[model samples]
Structure formats: C-alpha cells, structure tokens
Target: MPLMLPFAVEELEVFGKCTSGMWVYARNSTGSRSGDKIVKRDIDLCDEHGRVCVRLKGLSFREAEADRNPNPGATFPETLESFMLEPVWKPQAVHTEGESLGYARHLVILCGMTGFSSRDTAKRPGGMQFVQLELSQPDIAERFHACADQVFEMIRDLLTEKPQERVLLQVVVPSQGDQQLFAGLTGLLQSAELEHARLIGQTIILDTDIKFEELVAILEENKISREKRIRYQKGQRFGLSWNELDAKEGDVPVPWKDEGVYLISGGTGGLGFIFAHDILRQTKRSTLVLVGRSALSPDKRTRIQELSDAGAKVVYKQVDVAMEDATHALIGEILRDYGKLDGILHSAGVIKDNYLVNKTTEEMQEVLAPKVRGLVNLDEATKELPLDFFILFSSLASTAGSAGQADYAMANAFMDAYATYRNSLIKTLYRHGHTLSIHWPYWKEGGMKVDAETEKMTLQKYGITAMQASTGISALYRGLASGKSEVLVMEGELTRIRQHLLSEAMEQVIPPTAVSEIKESSSTLVETELDTGNLTDKVLIALKLEVSKLLKIQSGAIDVDLEFNQYGFDSIT
Candidate 1:
C-alpha cells in the first residue's frame, strides 16, 4: 500500500543531486482543506534559482486518514522524519560549489502571538480559521542533525498535541500590551549577541480575526526585509569653541568664598581629590567636606591637614551615600557644624559589566542604589538649603548606550533626567541653586577599573581619548558656569567621534561642517611648517575668521584686542 501525504501536492521541481546523495527540490502547496474548501493557499518552497518542486493542493487530516489503507496499516513513526520520494523527472547534473540554486535556503523564526480572546468569556466571538503551514530549509535542518530525533518529536507534538489553556493564553495575550510589541521586537534584535547563527526574534501584534492571507503577507514582508525590523535612535554630541571658553571664564562666577562649605561625594577617589584641591585653590576661606565609603588613609589625612593649615578647613567623613538614613544624618551634621550648606556634588556610582541577558537584578540595583537612590536621598535632605550648585556626575554611556553597560547606562540616564527635573523646580523654589548633570567621557586617571588593554582598544578602535586631569577639570568648571542643566564633555577629533558613533545611529546629530573644521585644524598642526612670524600671523588670521563667522560679521570688522562681550557675545551664545 502506498503512503499518503497529509497535504495535497500541487507542483514539484527537481534541481539536481549533490555528491552527498541529498536531493534538492522546491515545493508549492496549500494547507489543509475544510469541507472541500482549501484553508491555506499559495504555500511555496523553492531554491535560490526560483525553481519550484513538490507543489501540493491542500492539507486535511480527515482526507489523509481516509486515504490510508486500514488492513495494511503499520505502526507510524513517533517522530517527524524526512524520507526521499522518487523524483518526478530524471536527475540533472550536479552543480558546482557556490552556484545559485534560485530559492531562499535560509530560515528565520518569529515566535510571538496576539490577542485571541479576553479572560472574560462573554466577549468571545467567531473568528477566522487558519491552516498551518510547515516549511523547512535544508541548511538549517542540517545544523540540528545531532538532535534530529528531538526536533522531530517537538514538531510532531506541535501538530498533534493540545497545550494547557494558561500556556496557550500567554502567547495570545502577553503581559506586555500588544501595542508595545514593536518596541519589544526592536529591543530583542538590538540586544541579541548571536555569534554563529544569524537568527533574531521579534514580536508582532495582530488581531486574532485577521485574514490568513494578510497574516502571510505580513510575515513575507518581514522575512524579505529584516533590516527594517531593527530600530535606531539619534544621539547628541557636545563641544566648546575657544571663544566660548574665554567667555565662560569671564561671565559665570563660581561664587565660592572662604566661609562657604562645599561637599564632594567619593572624595577619597582620584576624581574627588582633584575636585577638592581645585575648590581649595578657587577660594581662600571655603571649607571642603569630602565623603567616601572608606576612612581616609594616613597619607590622605596628612594632605588634608596641609590644606587645613592653608586656611581652608578640610573634613573627611566615611559614609555610604546609598544608605538613605546615613546620608540624611550626614547632611544634618554638616549643616550643624558649618552653619550652612553651600553646595553638593554627587560623584558616587558603581559599575557591573555584563551582557543585558546575563545581568542579574541584584547587580543592576547595586549600581543604581548609589547613583539614583543616593541622589533622591541627598535632594530630599537638602531641599530647603540655599545651595550654590547641585551637581550630579553622569557618564557618556548614558547617551551612547554602550554594549555590556546597560545597568550603568540606566543609572546615569536617571541622573540626567533627574537633573532636568530638579532644574525645573529650582527656577521657582531655589532660584540661587543650580542643578547640573555633566556627561563625561573617559578620564585617564580617575574612573572605574579599566585595564591597559581595554584602554588601548577604547582609544584606538573607538577613537576615544581619555581626558587629561587638567583638561577635564577645566571643562567641568566651564560646564558648571555655563548655566545649562545638562552638558556633555567629549575629547576627540569630531570627525573620528562622528564615525565611531555611526553604529549607534547618532552620527548625524553633529554637523558635518563642524567636524570638517575640527579635522582640518588637527591636520594643519601636523602638515604645516612655517617660521615664527608666519605662524603667528596665520594663527591671528584664523582666530579672526572664526570670530567673524561666530559673530556673523566680515573678518575686516574683527579686532584682535577686543573682548568677545564687546561683539555681542554672552554666556548664552
């Protein structure tokens, strides 16, 4: 007795046989029929050359069972297995390696479901029925040869078994609303870290009652253009001109005095010390309060004593800002001892590097505690104080979304957002207080643990030059004085930074002409050779040209000795 296929074969085309005895064929068929009417239509299978083979008419379990011979029946295979059927035509010559076979041999798996029925049974209504289509790719199938039997069993179960209602409803009615399916899909694609397999999963929401043809059309469109499924966001770049730097120095006053009390979190760290020393230098009588999780070392204590002797009181306190009660108590103690709270600088944060999938909830919270919760605690404790500045130290990762730094990025992004929110409130409640979040690039001396190899790769491949302590401090001061709620400080050639950021879909945020000018300036330093007089003249001419362009005036109207403020330039510009 001959075996019967579950579905009707409509057409078939044989390409040729490979040396390995594997016969490649294309198939076109329809799925199961309901009451003599075809349910699934235009199901196609072809090779890279567009040759069709094994086309089927329709699929029906009832029809297939009826066609089977009852008396000659034998036990069926428990697993879905492949068996060769005699070719409808003579085999053609074997093709050479790398030859086009006329069909898509690749397979993409999209797994997700849409709303079928509400939990409320009264809302149930009749909907369109769908016929299942089974398609396979030889290349993909070969990859799972070791688990062939298991794969076959899974397919058999899918076709013949009924899942629990709860399990079935999960795919149909996911906890995350259907409207957000696209966002979830793009996120999955972006976060995937596939090394060998070119597979990605995405979610699509469809009405349960959608026509079968429409569903097939949607799947086909996505299959043909996978790139469209991934989404990207635009990012921003920040820079300062030589003229702006000079203007910032003259316009925005630090307002630091010998009697003011300034607090620095993470003060025992390298960056904290630098800021502490700079604050001392800026004022003759100000008091510096440095907070860290550990006690100051003997050497650090001696250094603090020196600053104390220099007339600025230096105090070091051991405190973890993440402890809300402890941070609040510490703030109260400072206010009591100093009679005032002049400023607060938050530089406390932690980092745990791992791929998003591998990151644990505890690790994320550990990083977020000091950065996000600490800020909230500090702000609540000092809400009534007339502070000069409230500065939060953030990172460039918040903007660029660096791979393996999701937790760190999320914490910093919170800081960025909170700073903006605080600034909005400050305009009304504490007009004298400024809330600023500074997004900084890599610092050569002070940062989370970074080995030499990683640093070298970051600089060479990513075009990111770690900021020198002196330059970073200068930029920090300028950023604070600029009166902006948020600022990003970056160090690199603009063109190189732009190129590096292209993968993040943020390259276009920076103007091309600005990058060109920066590139040209750096190139000029290497290529130009001139005498002292000629170089001085060239420098003066370039300065005048830049000023003219900035002021929107002719170069002839610029005077080298005139201050920028005289040309209608202010800190806002």
Candidate 2:
C-alpha cells in the first residue's frame, strides 16, 4: 500500500472556480525514486480555463523503498477523525509552582495547593461537557507552541477549579496527527494533560467534525463509560512506530568510519557514553566529539581514559545546545579541527515532569530548550557541514504522550517532524547524507530510571519491557540504514502491546492524515474559511487568539506587522 505524510497543507491562493473540476497532478520533486525520498511540490487544481482554483503547498511524501512506504500496510481507511475524545489527569499542585517543586526526571505529582475541592465520580449527566479548541489553523504554525501554551493553560485552569471532576476538552487538529508537528501539539498537550490528570483529576480532549448527533452519541457514551476517553483524531498510522531490529540488521556492521570524527550531543551520560564506547571500540580510528552541558565528572573522565586506552580519540565540549552562539562555535571549531564531520548523533534532552498547572513557562522552556531550540541551533550550525548521516535520538513519549511531559513531548514531536523536514532539504538542496529520527522505547538503563520497581511498573502499565544496550545499539544501526525519515521502534507484537496501550486508554484509530479526508476537515468548520489562500480578518483574529491563549496574554500584544523575531521567535521552534 502507498503511504503519504503531509507535512503542511494550506490551500492558500484559491481563486478560480473548480465547479467544472480541475486536474490534480503530483510531480516527484526528487528526480529519482530510490530508497527514502521526499516529494515537495505545489499541487495546483485548475479548472477548464487553466486557472488555478485550489492550491496545496508544502505537503511531503516519503517512501520506505522506491519512494518507499515506511509502514507499507499501516493506515486508516476512513480518514481524519477531526472530532475525537482524549483523556487527561489534573495536577496536584498550583499552576505557578514548578520552579519550586524541582520535579523529578520521571513522573511526579504536585502538592501544597489550597482552595481545590474534591468530589466523587469522574463525570455526571450534566458533567459530560466540552470546550472547543481549534489548533489546526495553518497560519498559527509559526507560533504553534505559543498557541499550545495557551490551550494547556486553559486546561490547567479549567481542571484547577474542580480537581476531582471529569471534563472533556474538545480539540480540533489537522488531519495529520503527530506527523503534522504543529497539530501534534494538541497530542502532546493532551498527553501531558492526561499525565497530570492521572496524577490529579480528569480533563479529557475530543477532536470532532462529525454531525452534532454523532457528537451527542459520543457524549452519551462518555456518560455511560464514566471512564476517560480520547478519540484518535488522525486515522490508522504506522510510520512513527519503530520496528525491533531483527538479529540480521543488528549484526550488520555499525555505521563506523575509520578516522571519522563523530559528534554526539547529550553524549556525556547514559546512551551517550555507551555509544562512545561502541564507536571507540568499533570505529577504532575515529575521533568522538562529545557534547554536554555539564563539566566532566571524575567518573566520566575515567571512562574517557578507558576509551582513549582502546585507541580512538575522545573529546568533550561543555556547551549548551540551547545557546546557539556557543553551539555554532563548537560545531565550527569541530569542522576546523577535523576538516570534515562524518556524522551527528543528537541524544541531548532534559526532563522536567510536572502537571500543566504547576509548570511555569520558564519550566516548559527549560525542558524544551535542549531538544527543540537546541536542534534548530544544531541545524543552523551543521547545515553547511554535510556528512554521512544526522541521527536524532527521540523518545516514545512523543508518540504515546507522557504526563507532566507536555514540553518534553512537544520537543520530541518537533524532532520527529524536523527529521522529515531536513530530509526534504537534503533532496532539494542536493545536500549529502540522510536525516533519521529513531523514536525509541524505554531503555533498560539511563532513561533516568534509578529503581527497578519503577521499571517493572512501566512494563506492567505499558507492556514495554526495557530495551537492552545491545538491542538498542543494533536498532540504532538498523534505523540508520532504514532510509526512512523517522522510524519509531515498535517492540513486541501490536496485538499484545495494544492491550497495554489501551490501559492508557489511547488506542483509537489515530487518524493517518492525507490518506484521510482533507475535504471533510475543512467542510465541518462553519465560520472559519481556514483553508482559503486569502487571509481574512476572522482568520487573523482566530490566530491572534490562538497565540494569545497560548501565552495567556492579551491578543493586542501581538502586532500583525511586527516581525515574529521581535517577539522572541527563537522559542517558537
């Protein structure tokens, strides 16, 4: 089966009438259809008059092989569940107390808040209600995260009033769920909300464009279940799901280069050093450049010495990826020293898990800077330094949603999209090397997991047995060879794993995007001619409100004429 993932679709610049119909043409932007490919072109729907009536811009298609279908047989038949339901949990602490809580790397509940009332029952007859949130509007793409901030805040406040009550948050996302990175913000937010909801109370999300009667049926169903629910807005999709590396692929020699200089961000600890050991031992002649924000600890120095004793060169750069200047300078220095960079392994990330109510904007950024902003910086610095491959170490949380990890989920989600974006650039710009993002499952070690009990609980809850170092290392090599933009390693059988994931109550046919109905998505929204090219006042107002909601600030503060950078645009990534 053919598969398509639309990165962005704005039917902008529609003018001529298509009543008589128009020709729909898809040109393979990539000259050759070999291995992994990305198709970027303007699909103009023109009428008999040869006038462009409808235009679709920036939608990309990637192939697993021969313009390959990454997950050949995985996609939903009836597309775009514009309206669906999702479940969430509230936070235990106040909305403004994150910096104080010093949240643990893993799940942690907020406490010490007053004025919240507890009650029985997650929902009642009248309690089965919802609020509309349209996060799919194209114009807000630049400020999507800012917009997400507002939605999450609203969720925080709504649930804050009555922590023990169950409320449904009706969410509107583009047909492309997680693949459409901007719209995926809602997925991350819902996941984060659910994360918090699991800790506090109940706040669910629903994305629908169905008839009101159908919605009523869903509501009645909600009333009956008394259990939390979240409709999979996007259809059946499988591109982001990673496959376990069979012994053959894992046994294939790793992507090692003799005398190659490899850069590993977030390379100081956990998987970083583990890879360093592999590279030094396997790629004995290569120079491993490790990047981390922390100073070298004595224990780390000893490990480096051991690797050095093995033969390869090991160097560490204490720099924060969030700081572009420092990051760029480090890359620059590396290029100067090594003449040419062979590969990049971006595994740098930070975790600050807290419920939405307790997490402040600063806290959110704190978690995002390393993965989101930092990746942008890395891209800017390395865009000129073409090499073999650019590997991003992503997480399953972005796919499954993590409580108290909206920022983290949002960041990784961005990475998932960025990998595809970078690959498109590679094809169009004639850049060397491919970009692959491996959305990994929980590792048996170094995921900041200290206790064995927590690991066991993870298995019990998600049916995800922690991955061993050897297995993950082999999977990493297999992902590098896969050629696809993103490979989310799916461990075990889907049938059994689905059982555990359903325990999280998030196993709907999460809509599979372009393969679904874009028409249905646009037709359902009544007062919003969102898909049109001519940007209207209502559209602008809606966008302003979107950002305003995210910032929890006044819409008036956003000047339409001002450059987005003037308002601190770097954080938007």
Candidate 3:
C-alpha cells in the first residue's frame, strides 16, 4: 500500500504537471510514516532557508503486517456515491485523472476504517463495522464534535449486529433531527478558522453532503492549485472549496549553495580534530587546509585521507612554522592555492620544566626559541597576507612564576609580553589600513599534563597550575574574540602575582639593623668564640678597637673567599 494519495481532483492536476515527484502523507500519529526510508533530490523549487520536500517510495503498514486486516474477501464497486459514504471501500481505485493531472506519481489515501481486499476471487463482502469518514474540507475545527450544530447536518449509516448474514446498514440523516448538526459544525469550524477537518464514528455519515469534485472545481476557479487545495479534513465527511487552500510555495525565493574554505593549524591533533568535527557538523561543507609539521608522516597522511573520505576537503603541508623562511614560503603556497584564508587556530607548543639552579644558559635560550622567536617569525611571514586570526598558544606560568620552573615561567612571561606588543603593533598598522586580529590562549590541557608533585611545587609560587591554564586559554580566546584588548587568561593568578611583587617592594623601604650595633656585636661574638669561650671587659674593649682598625682596611681589598657562613672576616686578613 502507498503511504498517501492525491485525493482532491484539483491538486491531482498540479501533481501531474510536476516534472518533479511530489508525495502526500496523513498527519495522524497512527498513520504517520516519519523516519521511514524515502527518496530525496537536489531541487531549486523549494523556499529559501526551508526544509526539503520528500517523495514516498513504499509502505510498512502495522495493520497488514500484524494480520489485522479483517476484510479478507471484500471487493469495492466503483461509483462516485461509494466514495461519498465509504472511500476506503474502493481501496484500489486507480484514477487516470489523478495521474494525468500531476497530483502525485503514486499516492495512498490513508483510512482508519478497514479497506476492501481486491486480492480475493470470490468477491464476497467481508465482515467489518465502520462509522468512519475522512472529511476533505468541512471548514470546521481540526476534529469532529457530536453536539455541534454542524453534526446534525451529516448523513450517516448505522450497522446492527446479526447472527445469520451481513446486511447493508440503515442510513441516518442528521437533518431530520430537531437541530441541524451541520450548523453546530460550521460554528465550530468558524471559531477554529480551519478550512478542512475529519470525523469518525460507528456509521458512515455526511457532516456536509458536498462532493470532492465540486470542491476541486470551486478551488480551480479561485486560482488554487489541486495539490494545495487537498487536505484530509479531520472527523468531518465534507471537503473544502478551492479559495480556502493557501498557495504559499510559489511566492518564496530560493537560496544559494554554500561554498567556502576553512584554514586550520594543528588540525591533526586531538583538540584540533575535535574542533574540525564541530565545524563540519555545525556548518555546511567547506574545503579544509590543514597546516602542521607532521603532515609528512605516513600515519598523518592516512588519517587525513579518512577525513577526506568522510566528505571534507582535507589538505596538508609540511613546514616547521618555527623557521621564518619555511613559514613564509608555505603561507605563499597556501594563498596561491586557496585565493583567501577564512580563519586559523595555532596550537603548536613545547614545554621546558626544570629547577632554576639546574637550568643552563643554553637551555634557557632553547626554551624561549619556539614562543619568542617562532611567534615573531610567524607574525612576520603572515603579516602581508590578508589573514583573519593569529592565535598564540601561551601558558599560565608566564603570568604566575613557578618555583622549580624558572626557565619555562620566564619563557612564557616573554610570550605574554610579546603577544601584547605584537597585537598593539597590528592594531597600529590597522589604523593605517591593514586588518589583522591576534589572540592568545594560555595553559591548555593535552599539550602537557602537570604531575601531583610538580603541580604542588608550581602552585606554591604561581598560585595556579596547568588545569587553570587550559581553562583560561579558552576563556581568553572567547573574550578576545568579543573585542577585548588583552584578557588576563587567569584573573586570579594575575591578581596574586601583582600583589606579591608589590609587597616585596614595601619591605625594602625600612631599615632592619643599626650601623653601630653591626660594628660592636659582630666583634664581640668573634672574640668570645676565639678567646677561651670567655672574655674579660678589658679584652672585649680591645677586640672592638682592633675591629675598628680592620673595618677601615676592609674597604680596600676586592677578592675575598673566606667561609662567610662561619663568621664575619676582614678582607685584609
């Protein structure tokens, strides 16, 4: 069985005229075939920024599959009056007018009542009781009501149970009732502002004894096409007039196809991959140009191929962005290939963690190599190009100093300062007509995980560790994108470090020891330790006089390598 059919004669003509296949569906929970397999196509006829129309191919009926079709040996006779009272009786009525007029390629007029079986050879009537009617256009509410004035105007057939054989049910005319039921129905429809509705009961009845053909002719005269005019009226047997159908599809505009390119750095890594996935899922498809050093690797190539297979324009190039010449050349090549760059995300980084004492001067230089020098190289190379974003991956240790990580902290500190300086320069250049935006993210996760011992040591000095850094990076990016000058990635650490530096300055203002006490106390302690662990008053006074003479000589000598931890010594001695 087909899912839906073009029942209205006027809509059928439009369906026949359509070179494109159109389909219909019953808007009922029980008859709904949503999520079922259907065919789709690229079309230019649909309204811009709207959902695509679908064409039904087949059916998966619950009733037929469950062996619940009670009418096994029933055959329907083709007549116009047969449809007026019982449309489902003529289940397989193939209307040439419906097909030739372009109502639909194939359709199924869904019914809640049992349908006649055309497969049986005997042509015997099947036993099934039904008082159901699918009203095309009642100009009433969404559903049928029993007490409404419109209810008294419908014609109905009542079925009685008998033990022997089946019989043609007795017809009931609601018009004979004291109050015309159709007037109540018309009132109900008027309140709802509905053009069509449906009604089902124990017997077949006409809520309004209007024929579908007559309604289509009325709709055609009013310039309403057949497809737009046909709607399955709920609970009411009557169909709607042509002027009632809304011909809205033809007046809207069609939208353009999505076409663009997205550029990404570190596109092969975990965070980069996740970002790419989100971009692909949330937005329309676009060409992707990935910049990374590992693009030359076989594993990276394989992964990129997989992404390409999944409908992404995956492209990669091998270049260490830390090198100036290489970065310049690669940027030139990318610009040549892709006419323009949409955006960029820089996630390249390295970590250097060691105690201050253990760090060599050479190691310090090496640690600063990537962020300080590499960033400058990248900035210089891409400055000429019409680039949209320049993101620098930074660290929290830069703002908050770490105890056992002086080198990494100092290096990151340079990055923090450099980013600000570069961004300022870019803005200044923009005032003179160059457009470029710079961003910086500090302490992101996945680059390096700080251990428990390392975190404790770092926190003692910096007051915040790696996790805070990662979160700060994301927030900083968001804030910067929202047009902030420079966002302190971690507000808490920035405040703490500022306070700590200021407190150390206040301690330097006041004196701790007097100049006279330094001269007397130091001489006495030395003399007492040297002179039999005890000193007479005359001996102590003599020691003080000798210390004065030595102090006068102490200012002249420059090279002195005595054990200063033991006691104070004269440079001349």
Task: Give residue 498's lDDT in candidate 1 (0 to 100).
Answer: 47
Provide TM-scores for the models.
0.48, 0.55, 0.35
lDDT of each: 0.51, 0.57, 0.37
Better of 1 and 2 by lDDT: 2
Return the top candidate by TM-score: 2
Cα distance off (Å), candidate 2, residue 465: 2.0
229 Cα displacement, candidate 2 (Å): 14
Query: Could you arrange the candidates by TM-score from highest to lowest?
Result: 2, 1, 3
> Tens-digit lDDT track for model 2 on 1-573?
333334434346767667635677655343424233455666778776676777776544443223122663632122211111111222211112112111111110111111112331122223333333334533323245555566657656654664453344433333233224443454455575565542222222334344344444443332222222233332221112223333354345478778989999998878998888878767658999999999999998888788878877888899998887898899889978888898989999988887766778778767777877787788778887768888988877766577778778777877877786678778777456788887777666664443444443343333445666776777777767767777666443344455544432321222212102222232333244365556676577566555544544334445444433333333222
Per-residue accuracy of model 3 over 1-573 as CA lDDT, tens digit each: 322211111111111233234334424233334444321212222223333343222222221011123663321111101000000211111122321221111111112112323332122212222233444433212112222212222211101111122122211223212112122222111212111111111122222343434322322221211111122233233322111112122323211113445555566665555555545544466667777665357877787787777786778866666667887787777678867555555555554554432444456455545544555566666665555455555444443344445445444444444444445556647311121222222233444454544443343343444443334333433533443323333322443334443443332221222222334455643454466634564554455445444453211121121122112332333
Candidate 2, superposed: residue stretches over 4 Å from native: 1-145, 163-180, 196-253, 457-463, 490-573
Q: lDDT of model 2 at residue 523? A: 30
- Candidate 2 or 3, higher lDDT? 2
User: What are the RMSD figures for all models against the true structure?
Assistant: 28.1, 25.5, 44.9
Output the number of the lDDT-best candidate. 2
TM-score of 3: 0.35
Q: How big is the positional error of residue 512 in model 2, measured in Å on the Cα after superposition? A: 18
Worst 10 residues of 2 by lDDT: 106-115
